[model samples]
Target: MSNIDIRHAHSLPPEQARQAVQDVADKLADRFGMVTGWSGNTLNFSRSGVDGHINVAPSELHVTAKLGFLLSTMKGPIEAEIRRVLDERFT
Candidate 1:
């Protein structure tokens, strides 16, 4: 399995940070057919070949994911998109 881990610092307050995380979750769900649910500050998500969570903290957002064999080959582009989205929302 291949992994993706990304972190971004955010200046927003907790509530707004969470809202920002949710916004990203919503986009992921819409674009990738990912099913997402929140457990406290961590949002869990899963779909074929992909599984991960978005963690919302006071000062930053962290995303961790594992990609299956076939998807693993696409890691570079996937990480790029994830970073792009995180940067767009958090920074």
Candidate 2:
């Protein structure tokens, strides 16, 4: 398995940051058939070959994911896409 962990800092308020995370989750669900839900301030998501959670705080977001064997090979692109989205939404 391959793991991706990213920490991004943002200035948005807690609620706004959470909303952005939810928006991102929605996009992921639509694009990748991911199932997502909220557990307090954390957003959990999973699909056939991936599982992950985004922990939302007032000033930072932590994204951690584990990619299964098949998906591990594409980790670079997947991580890049994630970073791209985070930059787009949080930076």
What tens digits encode model 1's per-residue C-alpha lDDT throughout 27-61?
Answer: 88999899999999999999999999989888888
Among all candidates shown, the one with the greatest lDDT: 2
Model 2 alpha-carbon drift over 4 Å, by segment = none
Model 2, backbone clash pairs (residues 3+ apart or across chains), number? 0
Worst 10 residues of 1 by lDDT: 82-91
Model 2, span 1-91: residue lDDT tens: 9999999999999999999999999999999999999999999999999999999998899999999999999999999999999999998
TM-score between candidate 2 and the true structure: 0.97
What's the CA error at residue 37 for candidate 2, in Å? 0.3
Model 2 clashing residue pairs (backbone)? none
TM-score of 1: 0.94
Give one clash count per candidate, in the order shown.
0, 0
**Deviating ranges (above 4 Å) for candidate 1:** none
